[model samples]
Target: MKMRDISESQRQFALLGGIFAAALVVSLIMGWILFPSLAYARKAQPINYNPPLHVEQIGITCDTCHFFYEDGSWAGIPTLETCVDCHSDIIGASPEEEKFVNEYVKKNREVKWALYVKQPECVSFSHSSHVRMAKIACETCHGPQGHSDPKDYLANRITNYSYVVYDPRVPLNAFTIIRDKGETVWGTMRMDECTACHRSRGTSTACFICHK
Candidate 1:
């Protein structure tokens, strides 16, 4: 080809490339801005809670709602004494509260809290894990519960939850994970739910990260 013609062709190609690149960058910017809002429309899998924890009223005292005992041992159960202290006062408050107190507490049995909050049976997820080791706040994933009104607690059903983990040896159903209040009973076991914070915050996860 002639030199002049070759130069013209090269210029045309460069112009086209620049235009393409500009369009690509604009598309990416638009996507980044819009994607998250669209994502909220997508149902969060694995952990599904209903009523969506709105109340701070499940009793904010660490010892009140949480089964973690003062002795550093998980009571894993709330006994009648725990209920009587407040239920005695809450008798006329509401039928639900009274039933929980008068009926269940009077039975000398604890409320059968459907524990959707769980990790793999093989994996020991201590509250101390994030609190002590990683130094991450609980609300990073659990959201704000201390301020959540008890009445607005998202009521979740204690149905089966498929447990997934880093280790294949870990039992799939090792632990029955409890969804927060208002979480759906049947949701997908998503790997992202577990890995989300780790990835976002650049936390290092070894096998001992969750599984011992």
Candidate 2:
């Protein structure tokens, strides 16, 4: 009778241990994999934009589209007015180019390109300071965006921010990394990245520098 009772107790213990282990596995899957997948919903851009194609075909640099105004403010994205200069007539044989000219340019409608990175309203970033004074190339911070395929772009559902810059927790394969001018560049424009860069350059990272 005593032997039977001991065996029964051991079996119960083993069963509970197995159950606990299974629960832990399920919890980890939900937390790490399932949750993130559900959180970030993929969104499509208003129009298919091929940056590399434009750069290759037209030989136009990034500044041609995103130039600085006379007041030293950065032109974040080109408006229809800017694009109309080239796109008033269909310049490319691609169907997308035709669609763009007819559907948007002819109708005088803006393409409404999705913003990949937008600084918070409280933060003030001087592009001229970084691009001109610091002499940082656009690829240094923005990665090889100029060389990237537009189809690779993804956005977050909750914040409407670019997944490339905002959600760094995703798999490494999701982010595009490229080597430019002997420097490896990838996206993840978080505070830590900025702080690390500042620390490397011995630059002042006072709260007032970023926040108004």
Candidate 3:
């Protein structure tokens, strides 16, 4: 081949490489500016929370609704005084509820609840933010708690799924396949589990999201 032709080929190859590099830079810039939430990360928290087991239930429970509230806010956490307001009059009526109130509540012990949903201390997710500020409701992210009851165990399972959910919006095969749903035995939480919510709707997945 002629020297001029060889030189021309080299120039063409260089031009193509330059174009690719420029395109990559543009894509990164666009993603960082337009979708910062996709790359955000929160810190991790390891806690040992052993919740009360009511009779035969495992992983799912009816006590979620046992939550107490006056106007709209929770009393921080469920308390002994909260249980008797409804159970004192009918302790013997429902042996199960009575047993729980008398055994756990009477001793001034708070139920050891393993909270599935959590946000980093540095990164705060206020209920009011998604509610009043964003004009959304609890059910929007939490699903339908009103229709959920002891009989409806699915919602409770989803609630206690640690940090997993069925995203209806995902395409038929678009699932991220997070954690592979460890089936062999007991397990530990993973960063992917944290990223699931963090990456959702552009929430942060940065170290600061969890590490204060």
Candidate 4:
């Protein structure tokens, strides 16, 4: 009777251990699959602007829409007047174009575009220095925006900051290293990435160059 009771207890313990291990495996798999989507809120663009299509038709460059001002400050988002210059009249019969004309152009309101690149308040970036002095192509940092299709923009809901999503064209091998190091890597711009690029180009390494 004593031997039977001991065997029964051992069997129960083994069963419980197996169940716990299985639950842990399932939890890990679920976390791995769902974490990325949960971390980001993939919001669709308010205006369906096909960048690649516009680049082909308009013959306008990226700088045409996003250019540095006379004061050497970057105009991150273009104003409504910029669009009205070419889109005042119904340039295309598309629904998006009609919506733009009626809602924004006629009303003389700027399209509230969600800015993708946002640095912290302490960081100061000069587009004039990078573009004019460094002579960097817009595509180098921003990727081939002219050749890519318009897709949903990603942002962190908690921080209300923009983040960089995985791009097939640009491999994010650094992300793998970040994950391996057990660090919380967001889709946003990382200091390491910026430093790496600067090192490659032999740019200024001074802390004051980027930090305010």
Query: What's the lDDT for all of these models?
Result: 0.45, 0.70, 0.42, 0.69
Q: Relative to the unseen true structure, what is the C-alpha lDDT of residue 35 in candidate 3, on a scale of 0 to 100?
A: 44
In Å, residue 116's CA in model 4 sits off its true spot by 2.1
lDDT of 1 by residue, 76-106 (tens): 4355676466655444444566666556666
Which lDDT value does model 1 have at 121?
66
Candidate 2 error regions (>4 Å): 1-6, 165-188
- lDDT digits (tens) for residues 104-196 of candidate 2: 999999887776666667778888888878999997777667675545444555655463421233332222322221133243365776788
Task: Name the 10 consecutive residues with the lowest summed lDDT in model 1.
Answer: 42-51
Q: Top lDDT: which candidate number?
A: 2
Which is the better candidate, 1 or 3, if ranked by lDDT?
Answer: 1
lDDT of 4 by residue, 29-95 (tens): 7677566557657676678777777787767888888877888898877898787878887776889
Candidate 3: segments with Cα more than 4 A from true spot: 1-77, 89-92, 120-122, 150-212
Candidate 2 vs candidate 3: the lDDT winner is 2
lDDT of 3 by residue, 68-121 (tens): 344444333345565456445434455656556665666656655434344433
lDDT score of residue 155 within candidate 2: 52
**Model 4 — which ten-residue stretch has the worst lDDT?**
177-186
Root-mean-square deviation (CA) per prediction: 13.3, 4.7, 14.1, 4.8
